[model samples]
Target: MSKVLIAYFSASGVTKNLAEKIAKENDYDIFEIVPQEIYTPADLDWTDKNSRSTKEMNDKSFRPPIVESTDVSGYDTVVIGFPVWWYTAPSIINTFIESVDLSGKTINAFCTSGGSGIDKCVNDLAATYPDLNFAKGLRLTGAESSEKIKEWISE
Candidate 1:
């Protein structure tokens, strides 16, 4: 089994693309954090207060059901990736984290965003899962070179 796993949730394809690139470059296992109900464009509209995304984000405790659970037992390091929503990870990330047994695994985070930095999301995950070994994090734009990704993961 591979030592590293790259798992991601993408409302659009941006984060998914980045995650696939990282996994392929590093020869790591990959998993998709799929929500039970896929998000449509209307559900993703941030301008609409009643949008599904807005409502989920507004309720910090909400964990949108995932389509399935991932098995992390074979991996020692897990790289979590997602698109930044409202300056932080979407609540579904909380659902994914809680679904798996990542107790002693090294958890690294990477995110794709228009402009938000990854610190808030990483900080939030670290705080939420204090027992896990949360390590490095990066903000990616999908155009990053393989060397840059390798350097970030190695760090």
Candidate 2:
């Protein structure tokens, strides 16, 4: 069996539940992309022009501070998960991919968003890790995504 890793970032536990379900279904190891500075509901208020998340999303180069890094060498497949931010994935995702040298690994991206899809995120990830193969991806609405994730995993 191929070794799989499910790594994700979730602020309100919506994405986390999805990640957990996929990991459990596939028997994949789980890794959480925890930020040094956690984002609360206040911090994620996109309506506020000056909100931290809004500002960070506006500045594409802003790197979210990661609490720790993990090695991906042992896993053949990595499912990178995150909540869509400002139509794109979180900057922390860039940080995660850069941290892991996924030279020849099979990377599958998954995401949870409000109403937007994961196309932007998938494209960005493909560009970022040109060497890795992006097999397939799943995107679920952040409201209640566990069942959707499980169905994707089964397929």
Candidate 3:
């Protein structure tokens, strides 16, 4: 069985494109972490303090509900991808992680952002879930070549 699973939460299509590339190159299974209530463009506005994204980012314990649950027991390694939200993974990501039992699995995190790196996102996940083997994460643009995806996965 293929032991790698690429799971991701992508509000916009940017992270989804990158996730597709990584999954295709690695011959891995892919799963989309969809939110129960989809975010509209207005809801995603970070500038508005009352916006959904802003409110979620402000509350550290907030967990945006995901549409479905996934079992990670079959996969030895999980590659999680998301857009960098307030310098970290989205709260829905926390909901996803908390739902699965990834105790001994290797977790490789990747994100897409306008200009920010994924250091804080990686660090946050590691700190929150100390048991999982958290691999170094990178910010990937959808334009990355197959060779680049292979290199990132192999690392």
Candidate 4:
């Protein structure tokens, strides 16, 4: 088993692609944070106020259900990846974080976004889960080189 784990939630496959690249480049284990109800394009429409994603993001306390639980016990570090929703991580990330015991693990965050940085999302998560050790956050655009990933992870 690898000491590092790359876990991510990808609604549009962008984040998933980046996560897979990171994991493969580093030879780390990977886990997908699947939602119980897969999101359709309509559900993801941010312009629609009543869309599933909009409604969920409107309620900060809402935690969209995940398909399955994950085991983080064996990994010393966990890299979480997600897309920026409402300028932060999707609520399913909250559900995933709560569902797993990440105590003592070095939690790093990465996100795929068209025009958002990873700082706010990482800060939000660190504030919410003060007990977890959140190390670094990177905003990826799916065009990163292997050396860039190695440099980020090494930091």
Candidate 5:
């Protein structure tokens, strides 16, 4: 059996729950991609144009600093989970991706969103890091079943 790593960044605990379920169901190691400066509830207020998330999302080149790095030496498969922010993965995901060498690893991207799908997020990641293998990305909710995650991983 190949070693799998479920690495995720959760802003509001939605993606965290999904990642935990996927990890427990697949018996995989899990890592949380925490930011150096933790986001406050006010920072996450999307409706306010002056909010941190809003400003960060507006800048395409901004890569938020991560608190720690996870060594990806032994993992062959990685599942990256996050919340959909402005129809894409948070800038922190870029920081995490660039921190690791995932050239030949199979990457499955997933996100928890209220109504958006994962197509744009996946495409953006693929364009940003051409060498990494990004498999089909999934849009999930907290209510998703382990069997569903298993099937998605298998795909």
Candidate 6:
């Protein structure tokens, strides 16, 4: 029996839906990343060119607060999920990784994106957590594609 942890940061509740499905399908414990200031659709307005999200994405010093952190030591494998932001994983993801010390564990990442592939994002995660094994990601969006995410987790 392999114990797993499913952790994710979702905006507008899209990624949260998929994250929940995967967790239920695998019976894994789930952790949601709640930033100090929640994001709304207007906040995510990319066209504004001055939105908080755009600012955070442009700068690297922003550290969003994670409401509830977890202990990853008990789990053999970790499934990390998020929505791609600016061709990379969200900066709050840094908060999640920093909260837990995953020195030699297996981590799988999945994300829902508009048109960006996850190669660069996975590379960044690998570089950040040099000691862990990061499995390839599942990139999809919408309810119809969430089934694929569940299927991949069961694999």
Judging by lDDT against the true structure, name the best candidate: 4
- The positional error of residue 149 in candidate 3, measured at the CA in angstroms, is 2.0
Off by over 4 Å in 6: 142-155
TM-score of each: 0.95, 0.87, 0.94, 0.96, 0.96, 0.87
- Candidate 1 residue-wise lDDT, 13-107, digit = tens: 98998898888987888999999999999999999999999999999889999999889998888889999998888999999999999988888
Q: Compose the digit string of candidate 6's lDDT tens values, residues 26-61.
A: 578998988878898877887778987888888876
Which has the better TM-score: candidate 1, or candidate 4? 4
Pull out the clashing pairs in model 6: none
TM-score result, candidate 1: 0.95
TM-score of 5: 0.96
Off by over 4 Å in 3: none
Mind giving the per-residue lDDT tens digits that candidate 5 earns over 1-155? 77889999998888898898889877999999999999999999999999999999999899999999899989988899999999999999999999998978899999999999999999999999888899999999777778888888867
lDDT of 2: 0.81
Error of 2 at 13 (Å): 0.6
> Candidate 3, residues 1-155: lDDT per residue as tens digits?
44889999888798898888788877999999999999999999998999999999899999998889898999988899999989899999999999999888878899999888999999998998888889889888677787876677667
Which digits, one per residue and each the tens of the lDDT, describe model 2 over residues 1-155?
Answer: 67778999988898898788777765679999999999988899989999999988888788888999899999877788888888778888888887887888777788887678777788877876677787667777544455665455444
Higher-TM-score candidate of 3 and 6 = 3
Candidate 3: C-alpha lDDT: 0.88
